[model samples]
Target: MWNKLFVDHPRTVQESYGEHAVMAASFGGRMVLAGLACLVHAVVPGLFVRTGSRTITVLYDEMVVNRNRKANKAAGEVAAVGGR
Candidate 1:
């Protein structure tokens, strides 16, 4: 996202933030989200913060999905062919 801003007229390191309030807000929101994610991880193992404490195991049926190697290999092959 920050790459979009400096694609042409790159901002001076010492004076960039002074000219861009939206960039400052974007960075602030990103930091807050990261901090919150860390806090959630500390309290819940394998629980996704964005998914509201939902266990990854439950979300993807990891108990069954992760165990079948043939299924995983097939999925990978499909993804490679599909250009995903």
Candidate 2:
């Protein structure tokens, strides 16, 4: 139950429990900051016109690319082991 609660999801993402915690927290922080920027930009159109949108784009790209990278890495490891 503990493993299922904490470790399984992180392992599936190719991260340890602590690593996943830190990374997820980092993403959440960035999202919060971006949301704040967006709220401010809503009121003040001239300021931070691109900051929030750019952050969203960057965060999304990072997630997709990282997922692909982890998948490719795992596949390569599997192939290497099978070849030997």
Candidate 3:
């Protein structure tokens, strides 16, 4: 049960438990900071004009693009071995 609840998703993403925890925490922290920047920008137009969007782009690249690339590479490796 514990493995299913905690390890499965992390392993699927090619990260160990600690690594996944750190990555998730980092993403959460960045998102919170970005949200705060957006809130401030909402009140004051001059401040943080591009901070929120930039943060979103960076996070997307790190979390989605990189993860997809890793998954694809692993899949390709498995396919190559299977085909051989």
Candidate 4:
């Protein structure tokens, strides 16, 4: 149960527990800042015109695109080895 709660997901993502924790925390912090910026923009009308969108784009690239790339690469390697 502990491994399932703490280790499995991190291992699947090729990260240690500590590494995953730090990465998740960093992303969470960035999201909070982006949300604040968007809130400010909503009231001010001009500031942070691109901040929210830019943050989403960056986070998507980091979290989705890169993760898919890594998973695909690992899968390909396993397939190659199995084929040999």
Give the whole-model CA lDDT for all candidates, comma-separated. Answer: 0.54, 0.93, 0.94, 0.94
Number of clashes recorded per candidate: 0, 0, 0, 0
* For every candidate, C-alpha RMSD to the true structure in Å: 14.3, 1.2, 1.8, 1.9
The alpha-carbon deviation from the true structure for residue 36 of candidate 4, after best TM-score superposition, in angstroms, is: 0.9
Best by TM-score: 2
**Residue-wise lDDT of candidate 4 within 26-62, one digit each (tens)?**
9999999999999999999799999999999999889
For 1-84, candidate 2 gives per-residue lDDT tens digits of 999999899998999999899989999999999899989999999988998889989999998998999999999999999999
TM-score of each: 0.35, 0.89, 0.80, 0.79
Off by over 4 Å in 4: none
Candidate 3 to truth, TM: 0.80
Record all residue pairs in model 1 with backbone atoms less than 3 Å apart, i.e. clashing. Answer: none
TM-score of 2: 0.89
Which parts of model 3 are misplaced by more than 4 Å? none
Report the lDDT tens digits of candidate 3 across residue range 7-37.
9999989989999999999999999999999
Question: Candidate 3, overall lDDT?
Answer: 0.94
Model 1 C-alpha lDDT per residue in residues 1-84, reported as the tens digit of each score: 666675333243222454445545655665566667767877995754554334332434533553465466767899999995
